[model samples]
Target chain A: SQCPQKWKRIFCTRCNSKRHSRDRCPSVWRVYLLKDDRPKKRKKLILPMHSIYCYNCGLKGHFGDDCDLRRSSRVPNEDGSAFSGDNLTNSLKKEYFQ
Target chain B: SKDEDANILNMDFPWTINRDHSKQKEIADWLTLEIRDFVSYISPNRKEIELRNQTIGKLRDAVQHHWPDANLHVFGSYATDLYLPGSDIDCVVNSKAGDKQSRNCLYSLASHLKKEGLAEDIEIIAKARVPIIKFVEPLSKIHVDVSFERTNGLEAAKLIRGWLDSTNGLRELVLIVKQFLQARRLNKVHTGGLGGFSIICLVYSFLHLHPRILANEINPIENLGVLLIDFFELYGKNFGYDHVALSVMNGKATYLPKSNWKELHPIKSTFQLAIQDPGDATNNISRGSFNIRDIKKAFAGAFDLLTNRCFELHRAKLKDRQGCSILGNVIKYRGKARDFRDE
Candidate 1:
């Protein structure tokens, strides 16, 4: 005497379904033969740059200690603008007292 | 045949049972005596310790005979344990002098042991990279995990133990962190159970709290041992100070009081700063890019304020009798402070 056939669950890849077995599926070979057609994306380029802030100075791109304009403290006589250190200190003190 | 079956019954496993009960009992008795004698011989003793040294010497000699210049040394549980039984002996043989010669020497020693009837149940594991023979005696039932490594010189070995000791505190910290996370059901990071990154995080957390925790005025090697002991005292249950309790008391948990939120914000910011990449301008902009250096400076400032200042403030609060018992209870529960009795 022969034994009864027992049912088993098998998964399907064509429709991403699990209702039927691969052997019972209609387009089993077709799904395996299909090729992916998505195109690859391009990569981005990077560039290097420095910030405006300088470590030497407490200001943008220059430091208070290395201020060249302040060091010279006087303009050439094209317009006759001359400012001495003592005059600047005297003006600052007068402003403070006021 | 019955007597033979009785004899077989006395052997360790793969035995046959027979009808001769008295013979079987005699075999059993004899087997027990043999096992007892072996156990006694294997127990920790001056003689056994000397024998271990002798075995190590013999191994070194065998290595040398095979390859004229091989350096051997012992390490691991055997060296650390005061009363160790059934602990495997670990040895490393350096074959940096000549690889091929060392390999040949290891093989010759194995062959020699076999010829001398000492290799009956001996496992001879050979390695090709550094070339060494790992000889394991089956009757002894003590494994010797041998490695043949390239010599990195004497200074490297001196640094090795110190480095190992220094991380001992970090290991305990990792365990406490793991326990805290587990208690709160937030232990997702260590699904594989306390990996290298997890350990690094724990160490970083402790170091983040006190950057000078690892600093010592003593020699580096001695400092590592001291740091490890300090770490153990901080987190070890035996020392009574539980890191989890301290972490909870310090308001690291989800149920923090409204008053603690200000103090906790900086800690959260430090974590946020750590995860942000400075190279990605888009990401930085999205996260509101503050200067990376400023974030680090802020973290250092906050770490000092949160750890040292907060600890001082909290300790001062303990002067009140109610708060004192809370601190005392925490210390007592963790086993940090011993109970006192009036005489």
Candidate 2:
């Protein structure tokens, strides 16, 4: 890591990428945060936001709220539009028809 | 002077930012100057605060006259140094706690205030989540909200104020972010928007997370500028609304075991925003604010504008500068919200 030159204080202990520090390396944890004021083994971690993985549906690209699989899973209405009234039951029936 | 200035920025602030714009302290310096100007213009001066203090002292005197044991304690922004120009002074009357009793206390106090001829337009938000007595003190020309419900607001404000005192650029960062919210009318929690205290907490959460600022390696002004962009970037794109709690005590995004934070706080899952109250973990500060989809939209817009210099320049032309408000139009620009009515 080239942090000692740029950050003047931070140093790289790992692969020493020229771009970012060791903690910020893609190989390391997403983010290294302390659980409290004191240094402890149980460090606080936050997931990197740039990943293809979604926290929502545990799928790729989209989050849980905007899950297309969940959306498309719901049964179409009498008029062919959709609502989430009986999504699971309706989706099962739709899947049976398919 | 050159050596001292170099010492201040630690030798490489200029050269370090040559290729990577993320480390651009120059831009941060510009943004810092703008924020300082805004803060100076908007924040109540020492004299004004003193006057408010004297007026509050009189109000306290009035409370003691009626109920000797009970005290009218000042909490919220006025208690701390965060109160903006003409913003309401939030005070809680430390007395009995109950919905009906709180209502009665407000009723009695309103009547007393009327008799004393100190205030007017004494309306009680009787059915509110935290029922409060709202009145306009003519002498100070400031609105005052008095509540009987005890929140950890005072203690939280104290903790934040302590942080503001300790950190060099925290006040600038917070005030800038606050002004941005206020301009956009997103800072008021009562109208289903973020509150002043919530904004303070949010800024604190960010400052806590960003290691460079904590280490005092970056100048606060520069840090504020850079963080201002990163603030929108993180909140806009990165931070998962459901999965993490903005824990001030922990100073990190406390990841939860459950998908939604209902187990941690039942009321939190009800709203789109998931900012955890530092004072009380159970209460979601953004409860009244809109659902998740709409919030993401606003943040996304702000993020785009801040990132694109061309867009900012264009928007800056449309700003309404009452004084130092560089973001008047930009921040306040209300983008379309996704209707969650069907959902």
Candidate 3:
């Protein structure tokens, strides 16, 4: 028997259907198969070009490190166990490895 | 009897059933020994590790010639100390020297390596999420993938190593679980299976939470065996598809406030198993090239083999009972890919 892992539903942005994505919707796939044509969405080509966002929180208007909720400036817990065991501070301890 | 060799071969390799039902303890003991031996067999030996390191160093040297300031690292299994006997070397090159726009750096690096006779099939897959240069050493048959992805390689490696050192027997337990997953053919991510990082995270999440729930007086190693069984059981039977998020950070199920994780983070939420990366909370290690249903089914299959009546016959006298067969069924058997397409 095949192991069943649920597929992360790739949806059609416009129709919000699992059957097809905006690029290859049934409406498009059916036509493209017969006519040998590209999807309307691709043909139009209105893509988001220069959109930059926080790599960490994936938010707008700031960098990942500068983002407010990035745990950017983490301090040891008040209990004082050396490192929070989080070890975010020493993220680039490349020298130690070298 | 005169033509014994041919007769034996013709008789479909004669086998004897010395299964003494009364000697269940002895059978369990034998299984345990087999498992212990399997662990050693699957592990990256000193020579293997050294060879891998040397291979990585050769690649780094090649890359450095082109870009003197480039920092090439051996990441993934080699860095994390969880490689099997013949695991591929995963390398990441962090360089300020190349066209950072696309994987242009990788393509350029690939061309440079090609000049040095770095073996055949040197391909640059620049369109991948982490665009990589994949090549195989023709002589040693060692495969290496070099990525120019902006990854915190050192931090990621250190975090895992630190976690391994945190608890006794943790490293061994992780290795054993990895072996189990590999044997079952469910360890591959590209073929809609769980990768090594995600598997390690899953086991960590299990061991972390088990201590709180199951209060046993057994030593850590024995405790690991029990936890391993539960690892299959919990993910197989109890885990909810929409409800719980698998995480190793807090050592517990990090519950999503609402039912759907995809709805909450639609942009990046891709996998049925959202294993939260401890180092970077935003990064879901389980995402990319995985089918949720398949992973769940693999767990369910393992659980069934472990708990079902017939399979349990051989397991009854074993210390962890499901120990021997759990690893066997997952590692040895190959199952068809169940319904996993999004639609």
Per residue, candidate 3 scores C-alpha lDDT tens digits across B1-343 of: 2334343344311211111122334332333333444455445556665777677777888878878878688888888878765677788877775444266666777778777877568887888666777888665668888777467666677777877776545666677667666766677888877787776776665554432221222234533333444466555544433434555454333333113445336533332666667766667677753676766666667645543432344435544453333344444312311111111
Supply fnat for every model shown: 0.00, 0.01, 0.00
Q: Place model 1 in a CAPRI quality band.
A: incorrect
Candidate 1 stretches with Cα past 4 Å from truth are A1-98, B1-51, B75-87, B100-106, B115-132, B138-140, B152-157, B164-343
- TM-score, one value per model: 0.29, 0.62, 0.60
Best by DockQ: 2
Instruction: Put the candidates in TM-score order, highest first.
Output: 2, 3, 1
Share of real contacts kept by model 3?
0.00
Where is model 1 chain B poorest over a 10-residue stretch in terms of lDDT?
Answer: B237-246
> Best TM-score goes to which candidate?
2
Taking the tens digit of each residue's C-alpha lDDT, what string does model 2 give over B242-322? 444454443433323123445354433322556665556666666566644544556656755654542233234333211
> How big is the positional error of residue A10 in model 3, measured in Å on the Cα after superposition?
47
In candidate 3, stretches whose alpha carbon ends up further than 4 angstroms from where it belongs are A1-98, B1-33, B97-104, B183-185, B212-216, B250-271, B308-326, B333-343
lDDT of 1 at B175: 31
**DockQ each:** 0.01, 0.03, 0.01
Better of 2 and 3 by DockQ: 2
Better candidate number, 1 or 3, judged by lDDT: 3
Candidate 3 positional error at B171, Å: 3.4
Candidate 1 lDDT over B1-343, as tens digits, reads 3335444444332111221112212222222222222223223566556767777776667656656676667754355321124445766766665454355555666676556433444454554443445546544544565556543323233432343354433333333333333333333332322222323333433332221221111222222322222232222211111011111121111111112233333323231112111122122111222232332232233222222322333334333312111111111112111111111
